[model samples]
Target: MANIEQRGENSYRFTVYLPKDAKGRYPKERMTYTVEGKYTPKQLQEHLDHEYLKFKAEVLSGNYVRPEAMTFSTFIKEWDKKYASKLAKTTHGNHVRKLDLHILPEIGHMEMSQINEFILMKLLDGLQRKDGQDGELSFHSKRDVYRTLKSIFKYAVKWKVLSQNPMDGVEKPKAKDTEEEYQDLQVYDEDEIAQLMEIIQNELPHWRAMFTLALAAGMRRGELLGLQWNDIDFDNNQITIHTTIVLTKGGPHIKRTKTRSSKRTVTLPLSMMEELRTYQKHHKNTREDSGERWIETEYDWVFCQFNGEHMYPSSPSNRWAKMLQKHNFRYIRLHDLRHTSASLLIAQGIHAKIISERLGHSDISVTMNTYGHAFKSADRAAAEKMESIFLKK
Candidate 1:
C-alpha cells in the first residue's frame, strides 16, 4: 500500500515503499511521485488512484528505476520497447532514426532528472537540416524534434519516471515562412487542370485511372499506392483510405495511416468511378493473360506491375514526370495534384471544413495553413460579390 497526500488544490503526492529483506539489505523506500495540474475533485481522485496503482505495480514488478540513476537513453529504451509499438511502423522508425541521429547524441547520457529546459533548448538550437550548411534548423526539422521530445518527456512524467517534464518550459518552434510557403505552393489552376485532364485521357487505362483518382480525391501518394481494391465502395462511389506504402532499403512495405483522422472515406466523381471500372476490366484481362507470371496477394492492389505486385512507392512520381515531359506539359510534383484539387474546390467556393475533410487533414487549421492563398483568393471574390449587391454597377 502507498500513502497518498494532497499537497495543493490539484496537486497530489504518492509514496511507495518496498518490503524489507530478512537481512535488512533492501531499501524500504522505492519512489515518490508529485504532480500538480488542473483537475476537478472527481478527476483528482481518479488521477491519484491511477498514480498509486502504477507506482505500486512498478515497485512490485521490479521495474521502477530510481529517478537519480535514470538516463534519457535508458528511459528511451524502456519507452521504445513498451510504447513505440503503438505508433505506425514508419513513424516509429523515423522517431528512432531522429533520436539516434540528433537527440540521443546530445542528451542520452544525462540523467533524466538533471536535464532542464535550458539543456533541451540548447539541444534544439543546435539542430540543422540534412541539406543545409547553416547553424539553425528549418521549421520542419525543428517541429519534428520538438514534437519527438515533447512526446517522450510527456510519457516519462505520465509514467512517474520523472517528477516534472522540462519540455513544458520550452517554447515550441514556429514556422516563419508560412506565407512564403503558401506563395510558393504549386497548384494547377482551372485551365491547367483542364489541360491535364485532356492529356491523361490518352494514357494507358491504369495510368489514366490512377492519376485521375489523384486529381479527384486529393489522396497522398502513399495513400494511393497502398489503396486496395476492397477499399472502394462501388455503391456509394467512395474510397476508404486506411493504409499507406512505405519504402525502405529492403523494399516497399504497407503501414497503417499516420493518424486516426488519416483513415477516411472520400466520395469521388461518378464519371471517375466508370474509369476505374474500365481499368478493372483491363487488369482482369492482364491477370488472365499473364497466367503463372501474375503474383497474386490477398491485398488485390488497385495499381500494380504487370506481375500484380505493388509498384515501388516512388514509381508514380517517376512515371508522372516522364508523362509530363512526353506531353510537353509544365511539370509539378505529383503531390501538387492534391493541392490542385483543393485549389479547384476553393475556386468553387467550397467550405474550408469540406476541403479539410477531403484532404484527410486532422484539422481545418492544417488546411488553412497550407492553402491560405487559395482562401485569400476566394475571400477576394466574396468581397466582389458584396460590391455587386451594394453598388449601383
Candidate 2:
C-alpha cells in the first residue's frame, strides 16, 4: 500500500508499505515528494503516479523499451555527440566503427526503445557466428564488438535516457581463450635477444634503437612513439614518460598516459643511453633539414616517419612482422616487448615493485597478477639455492 500525505505548503510525503513474510520482517522502501512552482497537490500526485506507472512498466517488461521508431544508427549518432568528447579519440573511433560495421547494418532500422535483452543477445550471437572470407570473426574483433555494446548500454544508464540498461543482464558470447596461446609477455632468451639485436642493426637499422628502448625500458608502444628529445635525460640516463600517441578517426592524436601512474620516469641502461645519444644527433639533423614541412607538433616527438610525421603505433607491428619473416623468427605482438622486459627483469632478480613501476602499471597488483608466473619461478630458484646451501654443508 502507498499513500501521499500533505506535509507543509506544496510539500507531501509519499510512503509505500513493503509486504513482509509470515515473520513480518520486511525491507523498508519509501520516497519523499516536494513540489515547487505553483503546482497543486492533485497535479503533483498525478505526475508522481505517471512516473510510478512508467517505472512499474519497465520492471514488468524486464527493463525492455519498445523501439520508438528511431533507428539504431540515429541513436548511435546522438550518443556519440553527447559522449564522444568525454572518451579518448581512439576509443571514440572504435565505438563508431563497431556501430557502423557490426550493429548499424544489422539493426539500425529498429526503434531505440524496442531492443530487448533477448534480441540484443541474438544479435551478438549472430556476430559471433559470422565468418568473413578468411573465416570466423577474429577474436579481437569479437571482443571489440562486445565491449562496444556494453559501453553503449552503460552510457544509456548514465544519461538517464534508459530506466535500466537492457544489455546489463545479457550474457556475452564466449570468445576463444587465446591469452595462454599468445603469452602476454614474450621475452627472448639471451641467444634470441642477441640474434634479434644483430638482425635489427644489420637489416632494419632504423628500428634498432626503437627495439633497444622497448626491450631495455619496457615502454608502452604509444609512450615509445610519443617520446621527445627533451623527454630523454642523457646525463641522468633516464626517460620521462608523460603522454601517448594514438590513432584516431581524424588521424593520429596525442593523449595523456592511459593511467595517472603511467606518467613516470624510467632509468635507461647505459647501453640504451648511448644508442639514444647517437639517434638524437641523427634526429636533430633530420629535423633541421625538414624545416617547416616537418610534422613537428608542439611536443617534439623523438620517433617520426621518414617525412618527419609522428610515427603510428601500427607501424611498429608491421615492421616487426616483416623483420620476423626476414629473420625466420616467430612473429610476436609489439606489446610482447614490454612483457619481455618484465620477464627478463624478473629472471635477473629485479624486485616486482620496480618492474611494476618501470612498466607504468597503476599498481603492483596488476604486475603480480599478469606476471605471477615469474614469481613462482623465482620461488623455485630460491628453493634450489637453499637446498644447494644445506645439502653442500
Candidate 3:
C-alpha cells in the first residue's frame, strides 16, 4: 500500500509499504515529493497519482532498472547516440574501439549496481596479468582503459543514472616515463637517409616520390593522402593542409583537419618542390590519358591510387611497414615520420615555436610536450657549448 500525506501548503510526502516477513522486517522503499505552490490541489493530486501508478506498474512488471545493470557496453551505445554528433569521428571511433576491446569483453553483461571498488580492482588486476592475447597489456594501454572507464562512470553519475561513480576511489597503475627511450628520435642519419633515397629512386621508382615527400615535407600519413593539386601553390612553393582522409562508418571520406590549427600552410623544401613539379607533369598526363573516366572533384588530390581514385589511409602505412620489415629497420610506427621531421628540425637548432607552426600544432605546448626529450638534449648541448667558451677564456 502507498499513501501520500500533505506536510504543508506546498508540500506532500509519499511512502510505499513493503509486505512484512515473519521476522517483521519491512523494506523501506519510498519516494517523497514537494509540489510547487503554483499547482492546485487537484492538479497536484493528479500528478502524484500518475507517479504512483507508474511505480506500481514497474513493481508489478518486475522491471526495476538498477544502476548496477548499466554495463559499459550498454551505456556507451546510449552515450554515442546522445553525443556522437558533438564528437570528432576519430574520437568517436576510438571510444567505441576502447569499449569493445577493453571494457565490454571484460564486464559488459555485469549489472552496474553490482560493480564496486573491489570488483573493478580485480578486473584491473586481471588486465595487468599476461594471460590474454598480445601477451600482457602495456602500462600505457592499461592506464587508457582505466581512464575511459572512469569517464563513463562520471558521465553516468552526472546524468543521475547512478548515485556515484565506482571508479572514484580506484588508483591507476603507475606508468614509467618512456620519453628517455626516444630522447634521440630513431631517424635515418644523413648517410642512412641518402642510402634510403637512393634505393627508393633507383629500385622502387613507383613509390619514390611519395617517400621523398613524406621525409621532406613531414606531412602526416592521412594529410599526405588528402593533399590535392589545388592545395599546392607552385609559385609560392607552399602547401595548405585543410582536410584529411579518415575512415568513417560508411567508409573513408575527406573530413576536415583534426583540429583548426592542423589546417595550416607549410613551405615546401627545394628538393620536394622539384619532385612535386615533376610529379604534377606526370599526373596531368595520366589524367589526360584517362580522359572522360576521370572523376574530377573540386579538390585535386596530389596523391591517389594508380587508377586516380582516392587512396585509403591504410595503404601507405602497410607499404611502409613492409618496407621496414624487408630492410630490417627498427619497427617504427608510420606516424614516426612526423616525429622524424620534428627531430631533424630540433637537431638543426630550430626554435620549437617555428616547429609547432610547421607541424600545425594547436600550441607550442603540444610541440614541447611531444618532443620534450629532444628539447632537453638541445638544452644540454647549449650548456656544453657555453662551458667550452668560458673554459677557453
Candidate 3: tens digits of C-alpha lDDT, residues 224-339: 88888888888998989888888765578788897788999999888888888887888888888887787755657788865577788788888878887777766666677678
User: In candidate 3, which residue ranges exceed 4 Å CA deviation?
Assistant: 1-64, 84-86, 118-133, 171-174, 179-186, 203-206, 296-298
| Model 1 residue 33 lDDT score | 50
In angstroms, the error of model 3 at 328 is 3.3
Model 1 scores what on Cα lDDT? 0.84
- Report the candidate with higher TM-score, 2 versus 3: 3
Clashing pairs in 2: 65-113, 66-113, 66-114, 67-113, 67-114
User: Against the true structure, whose TM-score is highest?
Assistant: 3
TM-score of candidate 2 relative to the true fold: 0.71
What lDDT tens digits, residue by residue, belong to model 1 across residues 1-393? 437876554455667766777887645444555556677879977887888888788878887778778999999987898787567667777788779878998999999989999999998887875554755666667778888999899989876777799999999876666663464468888888899999998888888999999999998899998998899998999999998998743467788887888999999999989988888899899989999998766679899898988888899999899999999999999999999999989989999999998888999999998888789989999999899889975
**Candidate whose lDDT is highest:** 1
Each prediction's RMSD over C-alphas, in Å, is 6.4, 10.0, 5.9
Alpha carbon lDDT of each predicted model: 0.84, 0.75, 0.73
- For 266-295, candidate 2 gives per-residue lDDT tens digits of 998898998888888887787788887776
Clashes of each: 0, 5, 8
Ranking by TM-score: 3, 1, 2
